[model samples]
Every structure is written in C-alpha cells, then in structure tokens.
Target: MNITEVRVKLTEAKKNRLQAFCSITIDNDFVVRDLKIIEGYKGAFVAMPSRKLADKCPKCNSKNHLRSRFCNDCGAKLNDKRALGESGDESKGKFKLYADTAHPINSKCRDEIEQKVLAAYKEESEKAKQPGYKPPAMEVPDLDFDEDNTNS
Candidate 1:
C-alpha cells in the first residue's frame, strides 16, 4: 500500500523517548492514526498503534489489564501468570503487554512504513525549528457545537 500522506505532532519535551505521534493515509483510502515516532537506543523508529492487553478476572469475569494486580470490578487478585501460559509459574509470564492494532506482515512493508514515517517526522521536526511555528492540531471538530449561542 502506498503511503499517501503522513502528519506528525512533535513532542515538546527534549529528553523524552517519545519524539512524535503520526497519522498515515494509505492510497487515499485507508487512514491509520496514533503511530508513534520513538527515539530508540540506536535511532528513531516507528511504532504501530497498540492497545494494552487485557485478561478476564476469574472471580467476576471482568476485563482487566495484563499487568493489573487486582481486578477493578471484583478486587480479586489477577492471575496474570495463568493468562500468560498454562504453566502456573509466575516467572514464566513473558507475554507481551500490548498488541499492535495495525502492522505490516512482511519486513519489506515494515521497512517502507518506517522510511516514510521517519522522513515525515524529520520534516516536521525541521518545521518546528522555524520561528513562530506551531504543530498542527490533530483533534476532530465538534459537530454538535453551534457557532452562535442558540441555547442562551
């Protein structure tokens, strides 16, 4: 899929590892948002949007985060180890805390995404250096809000 557009929001913090947040449009058809531009140990890299992994509480059957010590609803101690694996060993819970919402299937696709995202991030970073430059707002417009105070 061709990366048609990429918009980046550079982070204000200098020492932060999270450099920027980006949204990419693919072929003008599909749009993926919340992709992160992180400053890694080696260099900057693109991280796909991900959601925190959750496990169901055995007592109340309530969904709780993987790292949650106790269930939010029931207050029962979470069995994270069991969720990680069949084995009861707590030390063996090496499961990932988050899962990607959208990701490339192959290395080639990943490389292409990385290249485009990083390039856009670099461009945005340079733009930030310009005097009186402001990052573009990523928020959606409120459709329900009236321009004039109708209720008043």
Candidate 2:
C-alpha cells in the first residue's frame, strides 16, 4: 500500500513515542493506524513503505531499491546518472549548469566553505604533527582600524 500524506504532531519530549500521532493516508484512502517513530543511536527516523520513495529504478526501470543508483534487480544504471561535463557534448547529451546568483548567500558560499574547510584541515594537521613539539607563545597585534585613509 502507498501512503499519500503524513502529518505528525510534536510531543513535548516523550523520547520513545517521539513523533506522537502520525496521520498517514494510505492507498484507497484507508489510513494506516499508529506507525511508531523510532529513535536510533544516531537520530530519530520514521520508516515507511519503500514505494514512498520510488517503485522502480529511474535510470534502468528495474524494481530494486526504491532509492538506489544501479538497480540490484536488473543491474542497470538509473536514468539520472551523470558524467563530468557529459551534457555539453551533443554526441552524449545536453547538460546544463544553472546558477542563481541573485540570492545574497550564493555569492560568497563557495569562498566561505573553502575558508572554513582549509582552517579545519590546517588546525587538525598541526595538532597531528605536534606530538613532541613545544608550543610557542603568541603575541596579540593591535587591531585598530584607520578611518581617515579614505578621505581622498
């Protein structure tokens, strides 16, 4: 059977009975009663029928996993498989890389992400190599900003 819609109400902090009272409308309009919300070691998750994700592999049209890349049933690569720059070659397929830069966050997202990743990597690498190294004391620099330099 297939579930059409799922509505869950948040309990204060029931722990086990987490997503208390979920209303799931199943196939033929008959709702399945009281599906439990389970809390795992990692996090909370609600498991439903596989049909909720996909019935067949989109690429090969084989009924393997509802959500999977290559079909385990037929071993065919699914439809949405992508190769690097495969779309631009007319001999292959049309590929489009769409970017929406109007949003403020998109403008600096790549730079900000790269800076954070590099900082984390540097810190971890330094710690990993400093098993017997002595730590050097660092001095704080004066950070006063000059405001009069722009008055040309």
Candidate 3:
C-alpha cells in the first residue's frame, strides 16, 4: 500500500516521552490518525494508535480499565489482579493494557511507515524552528452529523 500523505503535529510538552502525533493517508483514499512519535531508549519510534483495555466490574457490571482501582460507574472496589493470568505473576504472564487499533501486518510495512513518518517529523520539526511557522491542522472530519441535518 502506498502512503500518499503524512501529517505530523509536534507536541507542546517537552518533558514527556511523546514527541508528536501524526496521521497517514493511504493511496489518497483512507486515513489513519493518532499515530505517535515517541522517544525510546534506542531512539525515536512510531507507535500505532491504540485503545485502553477494560473489563466489566463484578459488582455493577460497569466497564473499567485493567489498572483501575475502582469502578467508574459504581463505587465498588476493582480487583487489581483482574488483568493477571492464571499464575498471578505479571512478569510470568504479562497482560497488555492497551491494544493497537490499526497496525502494519508485517515488519516491512511497519518499517516503511516508520521511516516515512520519522522523516516527516524531522521536516516538521525544522519548520517549527523557522521565524514564522504555523503547525498544520490535524483535525478529523466530523462524520456524526451532516450540515443539512444539523438545523433540523
């Protein structure tokens, strides 16, 4: 798949490991947003968009994140070991608290995406250093309601 466009938005927080947020357009038809550029120990890397994993509370059946100490909808205390495996040792059988929403199926595709995104990030970073530079808008198109239906 050809990545036709890439957009990078540099993060404002300097202390954070997160460097920027990016979006990629594939073949000028599909768009994937929320890809992150993070500073890892080895260097910068691309992280695909992901969502927090959650489970229902035993008492209220309300959903809460795996790391939550208490339920959000109900005031019941959540099980800290809910995310653990049968061994009850996270190191032995670690459970992922986040799952990728969109990712490359193979290493080649992943590398390609990483290279392109990192290059765009470097370019954007340089642009930010200029005297009068404005960051590109990375707003997602609103698909929930149509303009004609809003007034009705």
Candidate 4:
C-alpha cells in the first residue's frame, strides 16, 4: 500500500518517551490515526495504535486490564500472573499488556510505515524550532453526508 500522506504532532513533554503522535493516509483513501513516534533505546521508532488488553473479573464480572492488580469496578484482588500466561514468553520480555489495533502483516510493510512516519516526525520537530511554527491539526475531516443538504 502506498502512503499518500503523513501528519505528525510533536509532544510538548520532551522528557517522555512518547515524542509525537501521527496519522497516515493510505492511497489517499484510507486513514489510520494515533500512530506513535517513540524514542526507543536504539532510536526513534513508530508504534502502531493499540488498546489495553483486559479480562473480566471473576468475582464481579467487571472488566479489568490484564496488568491491573485489582478490578476497577469491584476492587477485588486480581491475579498478577494472569497476563503472563495469556501473553507468550514472559521470560524473553515479550509479555504484552496491549494489543495492536492495526499493524502490518509483514516486515517490509512495517519498515515502510516506520520510515515514512519517522521522517515526518523529524520534519515536524525541525519546524517546531522555527520562529513561529504551529503544530499540524490531527483531526480528520467529517465525511458523513447530511440528507437535508444533499442535492436531488
């Protein structure tokens, strides 16, 4: 898939690992939002959008994040080892508490996305150092059709 456009919004907190938020337009048709530019040990990398993994509390039947020590609703003690089993290979530090909402199926696609996103992030960062730089708007325009405004 061709990356038609990439937009980056730099974060204010310089100390944080999260450097920026980005969105990409694929083939000028599909849009994916909330991709992150994170400062890893090696360098900056793009992280796909993901959501916290959660499971229901046995006691209260309330949903709780996999890493949660206690249930949000019932406050019952949760099994800390629960996520360890669900996520594969904790010994290798591959334990996951979040699941990617969208991701590339292969390494080539992933590399393409990462390269494009990081380049945009670097460009945005340089722009921020300019005299009067404004962050790019990350909002996607509404595409919904209104029946009243439609032409017959």
lDDT of 2 by residue, 1-152 (tens): 34455444333344442333233554548654333233445544432211122346655566643334577777777544332243534376333222222212343643443233334334533654567744333221232212211111
Give the higher-lDDT candidate: 1 or 3: 3
lDDT of each: 0.77, 0.38, 0.80, 0.79
Error of 2 at 137 (Å): 28
What TM-score do all the candidates reach, one by one?
0.82, 0.27, 0.88, 0.86
Would you list the rank order by TM-score, best first?
3, 4, 1, 2
User: By summed lDDT, which 10 consecutive residues of candidate 1 come out lowest?
Assistant: 143-152
lDDT value for model 1: 0.77
For TM-score, the strongest prediction is 3
Evaluated with lDDT, which candidate comes out highest? Answer: 3
Lowest-scoring 10 consecutive residues by lDDT in candidate 2?
A: 143-152
Query: What is the Cα-based TM-score of model 1?
Result: 0.82
Quickly count the clashes in candidate 4.
Answer: 0
Ten residues in sequence with the least summed lDDT for candidate 4:
143-152
For model 1, residues 1-152, the per-residue Cα lDDT tens digits are 89999989887767767778789999999999988777776888888877777878888899997778899998998765655666656587345667788989899999999999999999998989999998999852222211111111
Every model's Cα RMSD, please? 10.5, 23.0, 9.3, 10.7
